[model samples]
Target chain A: MIRAERVTMKFGRVAAVNGVSFEVAPGESVALWGSNGAGKTTLVRCLLGILRARGRIEVGGCDARRRGKALRSLVGYVPQELAFHDDTRLGSAMSFFAGIRRVPVSRARELLDQVELDGHERKRVRDLSGGMKQRLALAVALLADPPLIVLDEPTSNLDAAGRAAVMKSLVALKQRGKTILFASHRPDEVASLADRVLVLKRGRLIEDTRPSLLWPSEAGVLTLRLFVDAERESDAAGVLRGAGHLVNLNGHGLCVAVPGDRKAEPIEVLHRSDIRVRDFQVLADYQPDWSRS
Target chain B: MSSGAVQTAVPLPRPCSAARNVISFARREVRDAVSSRWFVLCTGAFAVLAVGVSFMSLAGSGSSGFAGFGRTTAGLLNMIMLIVPLMALAAGAGSIAGERERGTLLYLLAQPVSRLELLLGKYLGLGIALTGSLCIGFGLSAGVLAAKAGGADAAAMLMLVAFTCLLAWVMLSVGMVVSVVSRKVAVATGVGLFVWLALVFVSDLGLMAGAIVFKLRVQELFIVAMLNPLQAFKMGVIVQMNASLDVLGPAGMYASQTYGRTLPWMLVGVLLAWGVLSLAAAGVLFQRKKSI
Candidate 1:
């Protein structure tokens, strides 16, 4: 359980997180929803006591700032970036974390199994794919079996399969009664895992409600701009069109309409046709136009 | 739930003791440093330089065999003074700033470890690693000398090695302070090199300029030398070997007359002060560091 009252953190004249207040009951799964620079990560850092902020923050009833060690002991954190040393072996990392967290290596091994990373202990961190590294981070977080799990955009960088694997593990963790708090901008991710969504905008909490009430799971659409080589633009457009996606050449790139949860599909389709997308950006969000289709 | 009641209700994992956390982190640092390419290169350089100096000293003297520990150590002084500080500075400068660059500092701080424990453990581990390398380098040279030159003054050699280790600690402490304040590893390394240049080269030049321009007295020069850790180390070795500072000219003679048999201990104290003061400052700066 966590309680925050008017928490605010400032960098120079700008407040990264401002006067946000919330609470989570034990065993509850909550999501902090926001766009980039929307204070979600800052708020999470404040809660974790990594950043010093003004206001009262209590994790399991103790002030987080006053009792950081205990707060960390109660919360297992998975950062958005996988920053393990490339030369480090999984087994060595596990053992080192175990030693610091004062847990037996057996507990770390069990965690590895829980995260489905067993039998790859000898593999170096660099050899693991994006998803495997993320999962290993998760296992490291669970080294001491902390009561709460806090994740910062857990699947934001993963491919479809990688996202699915991490999502499956998270769903299982929720079922096992671990209090969950995560920061994400993906509607479907919040819908799938969050019981309550706390929407943040520009350093302030704008909305706090049920995820279903905030966004219908299947109704959202995202417009994306995919940039490819100039010579291959037509080929990329043809491949997307062949996949039944409505595509338009916008001079700069091809604009494709995608369902919110199926955004990875267009990129995957392009990859399958050997059309490499140099870059992509979400242009806008709106409901799909049925008449145009 | 109220704070007291919740704490009583849930059983949390007990955090590692401060000493245990420091030791564990230190052991990992040692392993990392020992396996690093820089450590290997540094050890090899020391060995080669030691052997070269030992052989060169005897050859330069037109002697028949390799020099013993006393002669070899005296000849190797300048090389140790140049190499040890640079290696220690590079190692310490990279420690925290490199972790920050790689984004692992945030992850490390997320665990139940204190900043003091991490910093102290890092210092201890690096100190051990540097000490180990120095011993191996000197040991190899000593082995050759013992076989060819018959017997040697092991005590004199040990003293030099000990002083060199202390010098490494002093520079390492200074480098850690730089690492703590720097935002990037590259910046820390640049600043460390600048400091090394200042201490090793510029300081002596400045002292010479001051002696000429201000007509500094021998006693004043001796005071200044005591303040400069490098000069103090050199002077300490000379006093240990010759039992008098006559070879160091007027300032050395002044120091010998003033401190007498206690000069070596005084110089040792100066090195200790440099290490301790720099380390203490680093600890304070590290504790106050807010950003990862």
Candidate 2:
């Protein structure tokens, strides 16, 4: 259902997504694996016609640029970031999206149910937890019952439970014959849902093979640094350590091991300690330097 | 699978499909606008000034007839001119930029809707919301005037309300363009205030300065007034309310003398051109824009 030939995205002197090409047949699930700046999001944006690029991309047998409306209408999309109005209630959002997609409101409710958001229609979107929001976004993607669904880092900010909920929904979508295409850095999500894996590095496709061929040989580790006040840094580190997270002090800030897919945990720990975190970033493929030595 | 021929999208109702998408998005904007305290405050400001001035005019004029309505509308028009444009700017400045920052724009764009439809619908929604609030404010006061002085009394009031809505629309369109270009709501709002200042203070001051420096005649001043929607709105109101045309300097005298009874219609055309062109430009620009 998807074909891309030599897709390249350039911004002035920098090429964000260089020449890359791949395809996904109808009912096939393909996961794009990449590091943070691997052009995964840019590639997905190109497929969705959000960005202009030099390439031939045909989704649902229509050129992405020429028939963007038809191409978009045929694909369900969940962006990497949380995408919903804070003040809007879930039911109203579903209805609004239904009107935009020209679908029935009942279908929205059904999709919400499929994503395990059955009884939370009246809740304001902002009131939902991280995982619930991810699930809600999934339901929105499934609203039109499109033949294909494209997700960009579907569970990038979610906790383990949220990630599980999104994975469950994807599995169910796969069983129902919907072609799935996603870009993600999480090996676990790839192992769970992707039939094929395409690895990207520096905007180039490095490997195009089955997920098993890539092998989960190296267990991924997450390294995070939280910038806090000197007075609160020791206290914040203790909170994370109390929660079973390994903590180390570096020149820049307190570095912590955020186990598994729970990236928000360290921030929550710091919040409980009344430490204001100024900034933070995640390194997904990190092999803790302590272990390296 | 021979299912390559399967149609993934159901045949949507064409022709009015763009309109439908616009309306759908518009309704959301209107809903959000009305729910916010900002819109409520705007409507309140309009109502308080309109109703309070109506009563004040009646008391001050001591003539509960056409003259009383004239004084009331004259007072209210200045307030509407100040309030409505600011409200429209506030409404529109955050409309697109805020949504883009929130990532909601991407989700909305990923659907079947076209960029033009989305932009138009958002502007329409915001325009309608601001217009509706003005209507409520004007209607409440106008209703009182109509009841006390009779049907003929409120006619001018309704006309003023219509012109004010048009002015609001013009500002909303300008604000939409700002929102489209800005990456964050903070920047959009800053740009919006700057625009309001340019229209309200800079343009009016510039016109007067030009009139003095260039020693512009009545006709030249009239053309300059037509160039600014806010100036057009004020002149249009002053002419309709039978307030002294001399207050507008030579421009008003030239408009009344040259345009005859069609000056109101000409002002309407100016407002429409301002509203339609900016709105259309915003839609076209967004179509070619990188939404991400």
Candidate 3:
């Protein structure tokens, strides 16, 4: 869906993206993984033809340098920063984009419903929480029904639930055969949504592999806190251990380490074991070793 | 769900026509401008100030009867000069910088629309909004004058409205140039206010200084006055009302004598040229911008 050859973007004397080359096939999901200032966003901007670079880029068979408008129309983009006119209601904003993308205004309802924002159409953008705004951006991106979706750190600022909701929506998009090129620093997010991971460091593409192979240690693993009856704490830990999860004892609960996408597996295991759970929460998520290095 | 669900569910959307995109952008800009609290306050303040000034002019003249439209418009000229340019500057200063700050500028640019289309839409939209506001403010003042002050001339009022709208458009073009050059909204607004101050007051003071120090000829003074759109507008209104420039002293008299009956039209043409040239420069500057 995207082919970038030796793409080098420079700001002054410093190169932001240095001779990076990669290609995404149809229906493939690729993640640009890196730390801040590692040039993921810069590279994505170059691919989207927002920024002109040294090398050649072709998105959906259109040259990024030559045909910006045509290339952009083929890709739906969700930016890392969410900004809309605060006074604009959700419905009005949708209708405005619908007109820009040349879609029927009525299509807004279905897109909103798909993003799980059906009834909040009348709410002004200022009234929405951080998560709702992200979803709304996603809906706007889909207005043209573009084949490729480019998201730059789609869920970075979101809370746990917000992140989960965006991830779920993305997963649904993937299942519907949308080719996605997203930039993110979260390892668990990379594991869950990305089929192929492109690791970037100081503007260079250092590695390209599957998400499973990138995590050789517990570095990016998440800690989930499961609260139960005080008497059943030990039982919950034992149930998690038997289910092949690494369990640790914490005050008032048991801590289980799991990848972000599988946080529910331990709970499902406990439910099947007839252990009633009281409450649960994510305790912490660690940055992977690649980022730390 | 099947992998082909999205493709099967929705057909591809058609490419938006350039004209439709520009119109959509303009409609949004107008709606935003008209609904803003700043627009409302400016309109109300202008009306109240105009009416108050008209009443004060009559009272100060020791006349119980209403002043004629020509005199009323002359009284309102300074007020319009001070308020309309400021209002237009404030509105236009936010054109590009405000969108960049809100991050919507880049988002919109990433769509199928070109920068020229967006900029043109914004300029046209803001022009309509400003013109609409000026008409309403002047209409309210005229209505009050006709009813409370006995009567006013419809043709004279219409002439004043047309000239004021032209001045607004010229200042608005300058403000858009400020917006395109400045990176932040605050900076653009500050520069806009500074430009307003320069054109309205500082330029006149500077001209006075030049006249005294250099012993400038009346023709030289008239030429300098023609360069400032604000001065051109003020002179245009005065000449239109009185059909002469006797009150403007030597320079105005020189211009009136030199241009004859075409002086007012020449001033109008100067104002129109300022509006068109400044807007064109802004478009070129905006096109050269490398970042959002």
Candidate 4:
């Protein structure tokens, strides 16, 4: 549960976040998608009350700037950069955070378990891998079981498998009724996981849409490939085009683009025409407006 | 969903509990500093040096045309004053700058803690750490004295230790201010060293030059002495240890004799003023720093 109204942050002459407004409801998972320097991190810092801003910010129903401490206690923040006191063991690090947050020490073990770093309590922070360090940071943030979690590029440094594990843990957090606001530049992650995507360009919000709404129902596109004898490839392309599909000859096969969820229809069309259907895949369902023009 | 279906619960905000917050923050700082290996090494080294110097001075006094009780105490006090400030500066110069470099300051400030609490806690922590070292060093110096002269110098040693601790407090506070104001550890360390040099060496040289050029009276000379922490510290120790040394006037030379009952309080006031002013400046600076 976090709300920001007309928030603007400026550094010298540059407005890092300009008049941005958004709300994250309890138990909602929202992805903040943007390229580098797109103000996503600035927005998160403003919400956390770590950065001074021009407009109103509230976390868990408390004013962020005025009630920063209480707001801090109600929110968990995982910064993009995993920073820890290198010489301290994981357990001591957790305990220190718990002490600062006024949380019980026993919760540290539970948090370590949640991040799948249970037995790593005694390992020094410097000894951890990039992924393990990120996990430990997450565990420290979760010490107080804050109602809302803000992650700034949480999986940016993780490998493919590590990213998957982090995403899985986030999904688990969502199930447990924790609201999450994650900022990332990776498109695939946003496509697969975000319930609502907020697209930012040059410190401005360009689009806010659901994954399903991103692709129009009647305009959904599919790429279909047909395999046949080298001499018959041209004929196969003609047959598919005659069936009201756009067809083009690709290297050794025919590629067809059919409108309105015609993937099944194209296969049937190939069978009837005696054209062999080799393989089919959807390259992308939604065509971004910037590329269309 | 209808707008009426949306439910929002807002809890009343509470004021920060200053006393509890200060105590907890102070405790955390003390724990962190005391548990570190650097603190242990620095304290051990200070004790050994102070005791070794005291023993050497006592044993070699006769061959070198042995100075009397007053000069001997003055020399020992001079060493304490120098070493104590150095120790305090080393401890406090990196207190905040080191945290910023390590990226832990943000995490600490993100909590419910106020800027005042952070500054005060850090000051208190360094004070306790340095004081512990000073006490051990002072204890070793006292033991050396007892073995050499047998109970004659006990009172003087205790007084010297107390004054040296006060002087260390002033240095620690100034270093904390520099640490908070500077962004990098290197810059803070450089500035702290410069300040120590000015106070200990340059200021006294400046005072002597002024006295020579102006043909100032002995009483007027005492005014310039007040400007230097090292002078105040040394004079405070000398006056306490021996009655014969006329350094403050017929009252011994510095006017410390005339200000008898009030001199200790005055020195204390000066140290407290330094601590308070520097600490307050640091608090204000921290309140404005952008989180990284």
User: What are the lDDT scores of the predictions, listed in order?
Assistant: 0.82, 0.79, 0.83, 0.70
Q: Roughly what TM-score does model 3 have, to 2 decimal places?
A: 0.85
How high a TM-score does candidate 2 get? 0.84
**Best DockQ goes to which candidate?**
3
Candidate 1 lDDT, B1-292, residue by residue in tens: 0111112122367778889999998898888889889899999998899878977765566443323455676789989889988989998999889888899988888888877888889999989999999899988877767666765577777888888888998989999999988889999999999998988999999999999999999999889877889899999887877756787789988888888878888999999999999888888988777666
Candidate 3 residues A1-293, lDDT tens each?
89999999998889999999999998999999877789998998888887888899998888987887778888888998678899998998999999888888878777887777889989999999888889888888888898899999888778778887888778888988889999986767787888999989899999999977765343456867788888888888888878766666746467776765667888899999999878888857533223322
Q: Which digits, one per residue and each the tens of the lDDT, describe model 3 over residues B137-186?
A: 88777776776567776776788889999999999999999999888999
Give the best candidate by lDDT.
3
> What are the per-residue Cα lDDT tens digits for candidate 2 across B1-292?
0111122334432222887988898899899988988888989988888888777777777777787787777778777777788888878888889889888888888788778888888888888889899899888887767666663355577678778888998999999988888899999999999999888889989988998999988798889879989988888877777666777666777778788779888988888899898888777778767645
lDDT of model number 2:
0.79
Docking class of 3: acceptable
What TM value does chain A in model 1 reach?
0.76
- Candidate 1 C-alpha error for residue A71, in Å: 1.6
Expressed as tens digits, the lDDT of each residue in A110-194 for candidate 1 is 7777677789999999999888899888888777778889999888778777777787778777877889999975655677789
Error of 1 at B184 (Å): 1.5
Q: Which portions of model 3 miss their true places by more than 4 Å?
A: A216-293, B1-8, B62-67
What local lDDT score does residue B269 receive in model 3, on the 0 to 100 scale?
93
**Model 4 alpha-carbon drift over 4 Å, by segment:** A211-293, B1-25, B35-37, B62-72, B152-155, B212-224, B242-245, B248-254
List of clashing residue pairs for candidate 3 = none
Better of 1 and 2 by TM-score: 1
TM-score of chain A of 4: 0.73
